[model samples]
Target: MKYIKLAAVVVAASISGCATILSEDVATVNVATSTGKKIDITIDGQNYTVPGVVKLEKDGQSKIISTNDADCASSTAMNRKVEGVFWVNLLSGGLFGSTTDSATDAMWTYDDYVTISCK
Candidate 1:
């Protein structure tokens, strides 16, 4: 029984990373406009309207948020940062778990909201 319990714990630790268990591969970000008017923005080459939500990958890459419309004021980028859960796992010496998170790109995250100034 003791050995079985130990094995179970090892299996769980190997399979579940802190970040992987707590985070997701996709994240939704809220896009809005300062003037509360609907503005068009481009992300990952796809167009979307402000005052909406966009689903983005949790990959560790910076995404360019831009506008083609002349009415919008400026563009911005969403930067990826390492998830805090991954650091916690690392600190806890969960090497396999942290490695799993890193391999699956679950260790990264982006801002939850973005606001663009529109004229």
Candidate 2:
């Protein structure tokens, strides 16, 4: 009887740990522009005005411009939720000789609910 109880306890602990790992919230956002034109971007209902000359980092690996109030809040929330890293990028055309003014697709991921905004 004691052996059976120990096994049951072990199984329960394993299941709980697995559940914790699976409960992390994560999401991704993709943005793209044409002609390298600057436009306002909205993610999760927040808006941000990104300049054509600025290249937003695709993942959390690069320096991020946290000037936007909403984007700053979102980043903070994400940092508290998941143990993994997130990314964001801007898709740009190959023209302009690798200039920041090129158009490109932007991608970003959040480990939890994030609000991004720019003005």
Candidate 3:
């Protein structure tokens, strides 16, 4: 009976340990026109909007991709949840403008990898 109680306690501790951890990595890609116009971005068939005021460098440089830790519900036992917002830009004639009005949100599972692209 004592051994059974101890075994139960160990099982509970193991389960608790697995329930409170989360982690994720995020990547972003930027595409720009040769004339320094707007940038186009698409991820998983979704369009993202970037501000026109933010112009791509003259030499067409890609923005530095970043990763961050995501918060998750401890009681829900989520190993990882990727969540964030991003933007994309579009150019029209000699003027630049934002193709979309608001930032878009993205989410991923613990084992999922997110890729962003410009076309």
Candidate 4:
């Protein structure tokens, strides 16, 4: 009975791993034009205004940032790797959680620390 209880506790604890708590499916990127102008911007086809922060989903999807400024160019970035917390989940026998997150696009996260200058 003691061993069974312990195993159950362990299993329950492993169900919600670090990946679920340490990361998210969205990323925020700061964007600006070369002239520090607030211009129209498109990220992954989503329309937004630059000189602002944009929140985007991360799931191995490549984000193409574009602008219409004559002196600037577009930029692209990709979320191609699973977050490190996913590995923590794997090591903790939380494969089910990790797999669930991946299937739900929750496990695929990227650093939300990027400044996308349109230049």
Candidate 5:
């Protein structure tokens, strides 16, 4: 019984980071245009149409949405913010959990929705 309990604790501790457990390397974000026009935008060198959801990697780096279309305006998405669960894990699960989240880059998150301006 003692060995079983110890093993369980070890497993829990190894996977305790809330952000690491809950978040993924990619997050889906809603992209839209102020003019409500459907246009192609480039993100991370990948072309995507606005007014849709795009899966972006949580790399802790800023992202800019650009387009060759003359009628649409480019937009910048700032650096990802620390996930709320990261803080909670830090306070409750301590440094081990928080560190795991940081190392995995699961602690980072971007805005749920972004809008690009257009003419």
Candidate 6:
């Protein structure tokens, strides 16, 4: 019975938040404009719009932003972060957790939102 309990604990720990424990190769960034207008963005040559979300790989690609608003100006690159569950998995010995996270691109996360100035 003790062994079963221990095994259950190990399995639970290993599978917990597996998506967020291993992978972070992509991120979905929510973009917005200062004037509440839609804006255009180019990341590594891929075009996107603002007041919307874009899913991007975290492989060092940077956002090159633009807006139709003549007044609006510059913007910053989107941010990336390791998921909080990453540490938990690490501490739990991960085992299969790390593998799942890596395969599913859940080990990392991106900032939920960003804004661009058009003035």
Give the TM-scores of the predictions, in the order they appear: 0.82, 0.26, 0.23, 0.67, 0.86, 0.60
lDDT of 2 at 87: 12
Per-residue lDDT of candidate 5, residues 1-119 (tens digit): 99999999998886677898877878789988888999998988988987999999998777888887777775656457888889988888568888888888889988889888788
Query: On residues 1-119, what C-alpha lDDT tens digit does candidate 2 reach at each position?
Result: 99999999865543332212322222332332323334564433455664422222333232222433332322322232222211111122222212221122112223322233422
* Model 4 global lDDT (CA atoms, 0 to 1): 0.68
- The Cα RMSD of model 3 versus the native structure comes to 21.3
User: What's the distance in Å from true for residue 78, model 5?
Assistant: 3.7
Output the number of the TM-score-best candidate: 5
Per-residue lDDT tens digits for candidate 6, residues 51-77, read 798878755334555544456665466
- Model 5 TM: 0.86
* Total clashes in model 4, counting residue pairs 3 or more apart in sequence or in different chains: 0
lDDT of candidates 1 onward, in order = 0.85, 0.32, 0.27, 0.68, 0.84, 0.67
Model 1, span 30-98: residue lDDT tens: 988777888778888788877899998877788888987677766787888888899999888888899
Q: Where in model 1 is the C-alpha error above 4 Å?
A: 1-5, 11-15
Ranking by lDDT: 1, 5, 4, 6, 2, 3
Clash number for every model?
A: 0, 17, 3, 0, 0, 11
Can you write out model 4's per-residue Cα lDDT over 1-119, one digit (the tens) per residue? 99999999887776655666677657766655556766777877789987778888876665677767665665645445677778878877788777766676666655554445544
Judge candidate 5 against the unseen true structure and give its global Cα lDDT, from 0 to 1: 0.84
Backbone clashes in candidate 1 total: 0
User: What ranges in model 6 sit over 4 Å off?
Assistant: 1-17, 20-25, 60-69, 95-106
Ranking of models by TM-score: 5, 1, 4, 6, 2, 3
The total number of steric clashes, by the backbone 3 Å criterion, in model 6 comes to 11
Provide the lowest-lDDT 10-residue window in model 6.
60-69
Instruction: Give candidate 5's error at residue 77 in angstroms.
Output: 2.7
Candidate 2, after superposition: displacement of residue 92 in Å?
Answer: 40
